[model samples]
Target: MQALEERDYFTDYEILKDPYAFFEAVRSHGPVYQPPGRDYLIVTGFAETLEVLKNSADFSAIIGVQGASAPLPFEPSGSDISEQVEAHRDRILGGDLLVNYDDDLHTKTRALLNRLFTPSRLKANERFIDEYSDEIARQMIARGGCELMRDVATPFVTLVIADLLGVPADDRQHFMNVIDAAPPPGSLNTEENDFRGENHPLTVMGGFFARYILERRANPREDILNEFAHSTYPDGSVPELEELVKMAAFLFGAGQDTSAKLLGNSIRYITDQPGLQDQLRADPSLIPQLLEEVLRLEGSTKQTARLARRDTRIGDRAVPAGTKILVALSAANRDGERWEEPNAFALNRPKIKEHLAFGRGKHVCAGAPLARVEVRIILEKFLAYTSNIDLDEAKHGPRGNRDLNYDPSFIVRGLTELHVKFTPAEGVDLSQASSQAETAQ
Candidate 1:
């Protein structure tokens, strides 16, 4: 096993495009290593990741990398670009959004956010998810296939979140546009930099959603936006308008991309494993477990970063305070020491529940329950209505950057596109499609 010295750990574009080999390399190496530049520590083992995430007291999420300065391929250069970007990040982080905070603030924000995404609410979204997925699957199968990521996963996840937040129908496209404008880690260029400067998606979406909340307060509606309009802070004071918008924006941004990736990856996995698809089709009840298995196998968020708040030792390596430590969740899920046959894709793996794909500890994803519901609903509806799914290997080869491929940002991991072909199920009646649609409409 080659040891990964501190100099060679940050994901290169080639490695990022196809990370399986890189993950294997990291696993063979010790869990902790300092990559080149001595700027960060990479934690690749399952137990090590869990240790770092669980011990948040010694780690901080505030690594001062956000917006343009957030590890993009194109460097931002102005006399004060770093300072400007840092200021913007601080402002956004200082708001009541859950991901930006730690300690007491994170706890409070998470508690309030948790209430909105309770099991009952997530379960209720199932009907909507099913209908949306059915509509997408119908269109895709009719065309003999489609790019699953763009055609099905992205739009379906986006609209479901829009509905949940009461985003007006007309503005959903605008919402997507803003999100697209935001700079992900390695995807940026000069054009992207200009876009980020002019229309930072988070800021724009935050403002847009805040206005909606203001309107909801004036004439209350039966939507989560209304709930946000009325939600009080722990101090019994209403959250500020900006805070409300930021929270909704966070949910909208985080929810759609990750879920879309998971859904697309699940479809890809099923197509890749013909036997597994048969198993799922034969026993539809296994759809839920299969989703869990898919999450473990091809997680949407492959890595997470934490800054050492104080000097700490991880697996005998000394991490200095202020050093960025990245935990590769994908590597952790495949850690051989933790599970029997860790690299194999087993839909019935009993230890699937222990995977940190949704993360763990105080900052564990609050939207996981909702995300699971979305995946299950889509898989169930898809299998029931479609058959003979096959990958379109020739036309659109894998979509992420071949070198520093798809999982550009450590914050979220997913393929840029998944193209596949499929045949509609035999004798599967679409006559009742309208009625089925009404459930989500």
Candidate 2:
């Protein structure tokens, strides 16, 4: 086997599949280490990664969506490449994305996003989310087995965001179809920046949202869509129509894959350890804490890329302008310096929410709140609706020798599919369990 330094994190499918080992090896060098022959710096230390993520002025989020493997369009000349970034912003992949927005634009745009996650809106949608979770959990339990992503996470997460976004009920299936048909953005198999094409979720969904926003503006409705349609920045300026479409489309895209991945990752863990499964099933309240531990250990996003817009230093390391820094969220979350027994899953882990799974600073995931609720509720229902959950040993061999497939992408860590067997709870009514679940909410 080649040395750890010889691995290509972005292109190496093996590394992309199971990167914790590589991250562990990298951590031996220190929190932030530039691997041999690689132009980018890998930040695996929680503190070092946060320091970089927090200093947005020094680091441009222009590369946030794109993996660090993707090269920039221009070369660095001066100590500050802010002007270069602005000039060539269009050339950078995913520049127009909300995650890549910076300073004033980011602040104002995020203001509009905040409307979608308001307390009242989420509270109001609680019924729909619970109902949806109950239905999917029952379906999986009745069948005795499911390809977790296809049978559960994908459809569950897609429609949760759909209902919240108020996509017309009649057309919800079409939106799900469009999203399902396309491979997620920035998959490892595709060329960098090639994931968005004619059928891309953002493209197709943006087209629909544009029409919806325009129509809602012309003919108002008493719904979240209407609020989103009329939303204005804190500075009292309305964002352009294209901006609204991008924001809405981004909400769906981001919410779907990451949330689904989290749900699937959580279930995988639950199935792996029978004790953990029984432990969680015994107390459904522990489900939320379980989700936090899952997010920390196996978050959907592995690492996020940031470009150094100005010469800066992350602790003792000197970073010049135009450098790509890969903040390893997965690695950082498990940094031994930050957590006790980092590799172990502990639902009672202290300061659990402090993990970088959803990232930190300004670019923290806006849909994190929804993701938390979505996955937690789904797990609760799954546990209540089922007597037992276990991996389909035929498809995914025995514990030590498993055959699981993960998405071939460097940016996001997710399973391509997770096949699992489940048994429905005997003498337990889904309706009663669902009602109780909703009551606790």
Candidate 3:
């Protein structure tokens, strides 16, 4: 393996777009390789990443709780980050939201948030996903082709989230417009400039929920938002409005952004491969399996940052306390040492569930179940309604010679846009049928 010194992986937007080569070059030095320019180490081994995830005592997600908006300076080699992080906790975090907490608080918060994404809620949303997906397919077929990012995936996922959150129909369009105008799902542009960082999409969403919570408190209604408003902390105290806003905002933004990326990646993969689309059309049951392969190969959130709470070892490398480690989920999933044919999209891969697309341990995505439902429904509808799906060479260039665009970010691995054509299936001409009926009348 070749070692590239201080590659500056984070700031280089072009390199970040296609970082597989970089990952391959550096994995040999991991489970704890420190890239130059940056002070942190990168955890590249599957087992090692798992160790860090499971042993939270030595690793804290407090840095993650601070997240992109309020990142602190990386402490020098021997210094502890715990103190620095704790000092600015309130100013940086405002208050403890789900991702910011650890131990008992994280446990209780997760339990409370679990009420919104329960199996029953998912089951109830199944019909809505199916109907909405079918509608989207019809729209795509009518257009002949679309920029899948804006036309299909983003709208589909956003609508699903709004419905699940009990946003009234009349208010849904405005909400989507607000989210669309904020920033692209995976872009780090906001992190770079802090432009409207306060009114960023997630914050805007939190603000919306904040008002709704007040209204629901006064005029209690039968909806998910109402239930969430009533949810209490583990100490049996009702959380303040601002806290609820953060919770609502986190769930909505995380759910919508990740699901959109997943759908875009899945479509790009299946459409690019020959015979895969037909294979999936023939047996829709294989979709769940295919989605697993997609996750393993192209996880939406590629990697996440964690701060080491205490000095520890990852593989043979000794990491000191306060060390910032980038857990490479994408690299770990493709570890040739752990997976046979790791890079290939093999639907029958036996250990598919081992993939960390949803992260691991306590911080696993809460909205995963709903995301799965949305993707499966949309794929099924797309395949059912289209005879053939192919990339719009005019929009995205020729099949093998296209400029593949990805969101330039350290964490989000997703296409910026996917333009594709869909040939309507035989006997499936809703538009034509409507025209014929109009003529007959």
Pick by TM-score: which candidate is best? 2
What TM-score does candidate 3 get on C-alpha atoms? 0.91
For model 3, how does the per-residue alpha-carbon lDDT over 1-441 read when each residue is reduced to its tens digit? 324535756666766797777777678665567776566777778898887777777777775633332345544345455665565555543235577566676787788788888889988888788777777777778778888888777778888988898977766776667666655543556463232267676676776788899999998999999998887887898877876787787787768889999999999888887789999999999999989999999988777767776777777777778777788789888998888988777878997988888888898888888888899999998898888999888777876677779988777888888998989889886453322112111
- All candidates' TM-scores? 0.85, 0.95, 0.91
Best by lDDT: 2
Better of 1 and 3 by TM-score: 3
What ranges in model 2 sit over 4 Å off?
191-196, 430-441
Q: lDDT for each of the candidates? A: 0.68, 0.85, 0.76
Candidate order by TM-score, decreasing, is 2, 3, 1
Worst 10 residues of 3 by lDDT: 432-441
Candidate 1 vs candidate 2: which has greater lDDT? Answer: 2
Q: Candidate 1 at 81: error in angstroms?
A: 24
Sort order, lDDT high to low: 2, 3, 1
Please identify model 3 stretches exceeding 4 Å from their true place: 1-5, 65-84, 91-96, 184-186, 191-196, 432-441
Model 1: colliding residue pairs: 6-34, 6-35, 6-36, 7-36, 13-403, 13-404, 14-403, 14-404, 17-405
lDDT of 1 at 331: 83
